[model samples]
Target: MSKWKRLQENSLLLLPSVVLTLALGIYPLLWVLRYMFYDYAGYGNELFIGLDNFRRLMKDTQFWDSVGNTFVFAGGKLLLTIPLSLILAVILNGRLRGRGWLRAIYFMPTVISTAVISVVFYIIFNSYNGMVNQLLLKYHVINAPIDWMGQEHAMLTVILVAVWGAVGNYMLLFLAGLQSIPNDLYESASIDGANATQKFWSITIPMLGPVMQMIVMLAIIASLKGYESIMVMTEGGPIGRTEVMYLYLYKLLFPVSTGSAVDQQIGYGSAVGFATAVIVGIITALYYYLSKKMNKVF
Candidate 1:
């Protein structure tokens, strides 16, 4: 075949993937941007209101509450999940019996649907009849069952569930990274009288920089976008206590119409959505910058 014909054929082969990505990914983002400036109920005529939506967002108490919840949820998950995954990856990387089985067990949770995990955890954390309370009670840890899904602890419970479901995927990623490191690095460190802790600090961590960056980026994005699990588990709560940004946006978009004044704030919800996009974008950029800095330091 002629070179020109081959190039043309390759281009044709790439067309479907490019078209699908644009249709599914790029188009929706563009649609959301358009909707951000308009006062539309997802049905009627869209009236462009310029910065009015944003203005309303600035004064909206619920929007701020959701923002605070999003931060807490994301921070809690990142703090616990990353370190735990790294530890599990390190253990699993060693030559131990049933290593493969253990790795599979750790990674199995990631493959389960988030919706299913949410439902299961909801039952597990139930205030009175839940497994967690029953276990605590049986063990004499608490005299009475704590309200795991109540206003005070609901957000914490959701954050814990998210971290549990997420750690497995990052563990696998870290394991792959650990395996990629040259054995000679460890050998040299040991020869230089380095202890296990020193060797890990000097060798394992530096080499795993890129993998850690990717894992953190993925985790942050997932935490920021947390919705389905929260929706299925708490439905934004016994109150708005567990309402993260995405769920708050959902409530705004699909108001329950319980005759509450705040329930009709669709414009305000769109504003919150736009604010969330901005916050997430800033965080992603900051993470990229920090990752680059860490890459240099390592």
Candidate 2:
């Protein structure tokens, strides 16, 4: 075929993806950008109010608190999830019996619906008559039923659930990285009298650097953006104790409660959404910079 014909065929192949991107991704983004400056709900004429939305956002303590809560939730989830995932990956990668079944058991939650998982957890952790408190009470572990979903424990409960749901995914990623590594390196390290701990730190870690960096970057983004489970479990409730940035934005755009402070403000929601994106972008950029520097050093 002629070069022009070949080019035309390639363009035809690419047309669907290009159209879908414009329709689903680029157009909504442009709409948000335009409406962020205007006062409008999903209906009504959009009134351009300039920077008022952003100014209100700056002074919104509840929104800022949700931002803080997001960092806390993400930090806690990453700290517990990443190390545990790596440990599980290392253990299950060995020549152990039933390792395939074990991997499936851990990975099953990842494939399950987030809303379903959250509902299950909510039932398990219900304060008054939940499975957790019932079991503890029956076993004489506690004299009284502890409220897992209460103000004092809501954040911790959600963090634990997040860790459980996330560990398997990162574990599989780490396992892939582990399998790619040649056995010769481990054999050489053994001959050199390097113990498991020493080898893990010196050889395995260094070899897995690129994969680790990518995994961490992905984990950071996912953790920051995650709020659905929290919403289903807590509805950012117990006085917004578990409210994260996206959850807060959801409320503004679709206020579920009649007493919610901000009612269905699409314009304000857009501003908050923009701010959330910027926050995520900044953290991702910072991680990228540090990873590049670390790559240079090692």
Candidate 3:
């Protein structure tokens, strides 16, 4: 067969997956677009509404707050996870005794269920008798146990927990990048009278540029998808101080916010979902453009 015909025949193997995606994914998305311009109660006839939901969303303070919260959560995780993962990867790159076990210990958290981790962290940060509070109190850091889940500290607590759970996965990515780097480069640097720190800064970091950029993009995308941990731990509570975009979208369809009832908000929720999709699209496009530019620079 000719190349074009051969390719067409091979694509037949993926027919099932394409069909499944259209049925479950594409159809629901198109349905959302249709209903975005109409008001429905999930049961009754959808009344046509033009741009009303978008206008209201433009004026929502709570939704804007969620945008800010989402950025904070994403930024906090990136700030902590990247450097820590890189540091651990660098340490493990050396020939140390028990290196295999140490790598396993760091990677253990990634395999654990996020639900279980969130639950464990929730208890560990509890006000009265949690491990953190007890340790601080024993050291006489404070006379009273601090409320980690309260308004003043809820977002910080959530960010810390997110960082802790996320570091392991990113560390593996960085470790792979480190290992792929040829040993000859380091040896050559040493022959040229380069110290460990000098070789690391000149060779290791420069070589890791592309890999680091990819890790950053992956972390950002995964952070955008974060909802389950916050849902299981905080439920966007303490007066919505820790509410991110995903949780806010979730609350729209499930719980009846004081501003609007559930039955009248099908279009509203659809609008929110579409808007969030647009934001994700913009971020993804920006990431690809930046990655291309950085690749040229590196």
Candidate that scores best on lDDT: 2
Question: What is the C-alpha lDDT profile of model 3 across 1-298, one tens digit per residue?
Answer: 8999988988998899999999999999998898888877677787898898888889988888888888888888889889999999999888889999998998998889988999999999999889999999999998999999999998888888888888888989999999999999999999999999999899999999989988998998888768767877888778888888878887777665433334546778888889887887788789889889878876
What is the model-wide C-alpha lDDT for candidate 1?
0.86
Of the pair 2 and 3, which is ahead by TM-score?
Answer: 2
What clash pairs does model 3 have? none
Regions of model 2 farther than 4 Å from truth: 257-261
Best candidate according to TM-score: 2
lDDT tens per residue, model 1, 1-298: 9999999999999999999999998997777777778887766677889888887778878788888888998899899999999999999899889999998998998999999999999999988899999999999999999998888888889889998898899999999899999999898888889999998888898899888889999899989988878898888776778788988887777766322344444555656777888899999999999888866875
Worst 10 residues of 1 by lDDT: 257-266
State the lDDT at 68 in candidate 3.
86
Return the TM-score for each candidate structure: 0.91, 0.97, 0.91
**Deviation in Å, model 2, residue 259 alpha carbon:** 8.8
Model 1 TM: 0.91
Q: Write the per-residue lDDT of candidate 2 for residues 83-102, one digit (tens) a residue.
A: 99999999999998999999
